[model samples]
Target: MRILSLILALSFFLSACETVKGVGRDVESAGEAMDDAIND
Candidate 1:
């Protein structure tokens, strides 16, 4: 039972990390696009 709880927690942590990474990428892309528009 303890092992199953640990596994579930680990899975959630890893998925949260991935979600944050994806958000970071999206923000970066938006920044780049804005910069391009400003430069143009």
Candidate 2:
């Protein structure tokens, strides 16, 4: 039971990490696009 709980928690943490990373990438892309527009 303890092992199962630990595994579940780890899975959630990893999932959250991926979600945050995706959001970061999206924000970075938006910033890059804006910069390009401003420069042009």
Candidate 3:
């Protein structure tokens, strides 16, 4: 039972990390686009 709980927690943590990483990538892309528009 404890092992199952640990596995579930780990899975949630990993998924959360991936979600945050995706958001970070989106923000970076937006910033780059804005910078390019300004330079152009």
Candidate 4:
């Protein structure tokens, strides 16, 4: 039971990290696009 709760907590932590990473990547891509447009 303790092990199961630990695993669940770890899973949530990892998932949250992934979600933040995905948002960061999207923001970076959008910034790049804007820079390209400005340069062009």
lDDT of 1 at 8: 100
Quote the RMSD, in angstroms, for model 1.
0.4
lDDT score for candidate 1 against the true structure: 1.00
Give TM-scores for every candidate, taking all chains together and pairing residue i with residue i. Answer: 0.96, 0.95, 0.95, 0.88
lDDT of 2: 1.00
Can you write out model 4's per-residue Cα lDDT over 1-40, one digit (the tens) per residue? 9999999999999999999999999999999999999999
Lowest-sum lDDT 10-residue window in model 1: 1-10
lDDT: worst 10-residue window of model 2? 1-10
Number of colliding residue pairs in model 2: 0
Score candidate 4 by TM-score against the native: 0.88
Q: Residues 1-40, candidate 1, lDDT per residue (tens digit)?
A: 9999999999999999999999999999999999999999
Model 4: residues with Cα > 4 Å off, grouped in runs: none
Give the Å error, residue 32, model 4.
0.1
Number of backbone clashes in candidate 1: 0
lDDT of 4 at 18: 100
